[model samples]
Target: MGIPRALLVLCIATAFLSLGPRGSLGRSHLHKRQQSHGRRGNGGHRLQSPVDSPADPPAAGTSTTVTPSNSSSDSSVFDVRSFGAVGDGVTDDTEAFRSAWRAACSVESATLSVPSDGVFMITSTIFPGPCQPGLVFQVDGVVMPPDGPQCWPKSDSKHQWLVFYQLEGMTLRGEGTIEGNGEDWWSLPCKPHRGPHGSTLPGSCDSPVLIRFFMSCNLTVRDLRIENSPQFHIKFDACEDVHIEGLSINSPAFSPNTDGVHIENTRSVTIYNSMISNGDDCISIGPGCSDVDIQNVTCGPGHGISIGSLGMHNSEACVSNVSVKNAVIRNSDNGVRIKTWQGGMGSVSDISFDTVYMENVRNCIIIDQYYCSNKGYCQNQSSAVYVSGVTYANIKGTYDVRSPPMHFACSDTLPCTNITMSEVELLPHEGELVDDPFCWNAYGVMRTVTIPPIPCLQDGQPESLQEIPNLGC
Candidate 1:
């Protein structure tokens, strides 16, 4: 006889519980509700607006509160030490957190508070639900990983270390750090390397992301510094109502696949007042995400903010309702980019980039449908995705190289359309702009750019000295 799917899932959950701290036997209770019918796979069903749900509102004159310092002002603040957790940074504090979270499950205004100047080593996942309103994971100190690889769970899953899944109305606040001692994990031996960088040699390295959130709602993470990640710094998947502010992510500039932040399959997310410096894209917005706003961000020595490289496998993947404004990028690969894979299906629309400052940029603006390939050598002849309804305004930047200040390469199949640009001026690096200042496939059109004289087309000019146009301005 074979075990049922739900039973199999339960067994996995139980196994995880056994690895938890002593006396912190957090049990998993399964309750089937009609709402479960709407959920899909890991890529769950898209969520409708909260107004469309039939849920009742909170009672009038009732509000939740959290008190971090044990003031007499709130009844909801709970010390994590009560659950046997020590925030000494050296102690294994995973179990204490589990107990605190479990106890908060029944409270309307519960908080799992962490005292200042201690390190809490986390080895397990922290799951918070809607009932735990005003739930705060206040980290005034560092939340560090266990010392060695042996202390971490030996698993093949992507989230082998620590992860947060399917929580609501939760906030992670602190003037602290989430540190991943990634030298061991990322330097592990793996095959068919899966990162922005190409395949690695045997016994080389495999980068794993530090933090990941899946299918969560109403989440806020503020005033935190995440450092030394193996792969992507942070990833949010299929989450809604997410806000991240005043966060700093720092990693080695040469770290492979260390994307600063990635938001995929989500909605209503805002990332603001953040500083990110990594090897890969500072921010990457994947498919099925919408209503994203990024502001007051400073990125450098990394790939700039991008939309797509989408339509990888499926026929439809939509990325819409995005705005990138009031940001600064310096010494980066490209300032603004939109890329899509060939032979996939989807559309990118309603996107806007405004008030961006770039300095010493290799390419001030670029839309490369032909991405992730050797220079000028793309695999597929046509692109699988569609890009349209994009606007770039008030872009002030400097180009470091003679490469084009702006380059747009749309797919021959689904050419880019409905694009507009205004007040986008690219100062010369050493010479003038390309005379034609435009290149387009048969299906697309290049409009709105003021052409300039093409320089370095002949004579002793190096191939790198050729000028590309700043079209659409």
Candidate 2:
């Protein structure tokens, strides 16, 4: 087999996330590629090969001056075009961008700019920091990576493409697009697509994450249009005081592993005024995350905003204080979900979703403690993540009748407690009304009447949770 169709997925507990094809965003479709893996046609744009460096300065007319707001007129602006970037669709502009970054990183409040009418193709790139504060990355034009897997840099980790490390007080905002030519990546057999292999296989399928902010702080990413990532679109890991605003992330409903906004092990986050549609979750808050507020989000044709698939591989994970409000989810698989695996230790609490509306979604609200990667049969284990203090209010939706609108399948040994629901009305979009909600070993109440009334929820805490044992959570 040429690539084993890249069969295999490994989430080491030890590891992290995946792409789904449950609705429009799953990697499970088994469609053969009509075009073989190769560099893409430039779509009327001329193509240029990568160069080691600029042998000469920019020809002219491509350079532009940039002045940061609230800064002196002398604030340095470094344009990539000035460093010999041919922003055609197929030029190797990686070195040009790096040189501009160096020049801008040296000075405080410097602006690194890209031309508004260019399509610069870069390779696997990392922008490391701890440099000058308030560095601005302005993307008024399109910045994209090499076309597909074969075009990817073999020496680089296939797990990640563009990465920013250890940056502080950096702002990345623009009116342009960061396009991921991900069609080839999504074709790998390992992606959760319809196939003989089912959804997930056990092994390694290393698809690159589009953009990652690692160990950075006080970062701002706003007003960007990102599309068709090979994997997770934007990830902030181990970052603090992060603000994401006015961003639109889009990928094909059938794209694999293309989560819109995924934040993990990060805190003090505010993701506001964003619209996400893809194959996976619109916004995924992963382990070690806290103090996250997501509002005014429009999510659809994907997995809904989720808090976890945490506590995998018997690992310890903790997530808390996440709030999602004033959101709309349409034609999605799951909405406002919390999923954790068995035999894991951790706690997920203080999460709330309020005033949200859904349309034609499969699962409007859910919590799955028996989450597994389908590696094999996950043996039922006693230990589980502690889930509590989750609230859902004013969530009205039309749903697909295949699954119940509300499913709270808490762990058998460690039942979920303090669950609250109010004014949630879910009805079938066109078919007959589905069954009542499915609840097991869950403790909660309804402050107001709900459609298909949930009489299955236990009114009091489960006796199994009376003396909660701390499993190093």
Candidate 3:
């Protein structure tokens, strides 16, 4: 893959690269809950969640105590304070947390508690699991790392901060907050807005990604509040059967690259009812992802939900069977986007954006075949990631007049086909101006009358059907 894709998808990089074997860590009694699958007009059916579903996470910002299920509450409790954590906000509490986890992991149905009241400061840490049975990582107190880049250990990776590896049948929910002290990292001269005139900074320019889960299955993260990450807030990479709900991810509008939730090389994921106000993409779907369902998310002061930004470095990328519905996007850079670099090789298909309300959003609905994160991340090439079977339905709201409400800037050589738009009534300048939408090499049908009427879409299929092989995960 290319360097741009490598920026986010590269194993969080170097400091810890060994994945010797999947540990025999954790598992709880499994259960399932039915959730709505698709948007309107499809007569959506309910889909059952993947096996591992313990009790729900605590509501965001609430101080609800978590108790282990089917186990004596007192006996199964493993408290960090009891393990010698001072919790005074400045002391190093990493060992205490590790001790608590060890005790909790030894027992079946145990809860590791970072109870309410203390501000636990710890360094970059990894909690590797496969423990006994089910385990709960309860965070009702404030958890943060050392203040800045200078405080970070050179021996530790700048790419990862708090990581959970090989954990299954686990629930990480709490009213408490996981604060990412990202300001200094964001201030590095190498960062976008911080770069000096034609000058480069010394040392590593990487910032720690806050809270990541790798090679885990049947995971649940809900009702949590994460803020000001040096990078992404919550990322699930190479994980399966995941469900994320009721999260509030926040950062300054200008905070660099603080994506709310990102998933890559993962499958069967569900993100529901989350409120994210950040600086970058509210949620990004990277390569090798499928069967994703996102609903009732409120995103703003950030870039909207996106797919790909893929196939960079002339690599094969595939994403399919994704749906985003009942979402509210406001004051964001883009509404719902499908982006790929010029020379990308795979395909993006079977995507839907339904019943999304946009308010003053720029590039309300867009497909950019020539996507570049920075000024020159990727150079133009003839080959492109094929895009097809995309639907934009019932998307209504006011939009920023600076850019086109709906833009389909497909590849010059490989046009986007099966691009259907229905009941999309976006009016520029706060529901008043009727600017014409833009389209280039995009072919599809408009089910009903669009607000400004898109007369630029071509009326047939492309001749590249055989070019896109189904690369399902």
Report clashes for each candidate as comma-separated counts.
8, 13, 5
lDDT of 2: 0.83
TM-score of 3: 0.82
Superposed model 2: Cα runs more than 4 Å off: 1-52, 55-75, 197-204
All models, RMSD in angstroms: 17.3, 17.5, 18.3
lDDT of each: 0.66, 0.83, 0.81
Question: Which candidate, 1 or 3, has the higher TM-score?
Answer: 3
TM-score winner among the candidates?
Answer: 2
Q: What tens-digit string does per-residue lDDT give for candidate 2 at 1-473?
A: 34343343333322333323222322221122222223437542435645557433322223233222211223366667666688777778888888778777777778777766677788889999887988999887788887777777778788888899999999998878888888888887666844574765544578899999999999999998899899999999999999999999999888876899999999999999999999999999889999999999999899999888888888899999999999999999998899999988989989899999999999998999998877577888998989999999999979999998999999988999999989989889879998689999999989999987899999977876778778564
lDDT of 1 at 18: 76
Error of 3 at 196 (Å): 6.3
User: Between prediction 1 and prediction 3, which has the larger lDDT?
Assistant: 3
What's the CA error at residue 435 for candidate 2, in Å? 3.5
Query: Clashing residue pairs in candidate 3, if any?
Result: 24-130, 25-130, 25-131, 26-130, 26-131
Tens-place lDDT per residue, model 3, 11-117, is 66543454421122222222221122111121222122221232323332332232233122255766676566666666667777887787777777787877666
TM-score of each candidate? Answer: 0.73, 0.86, 0.82
In terms of lDDT, the poorest run of 10 residues in model 3 is 33-42
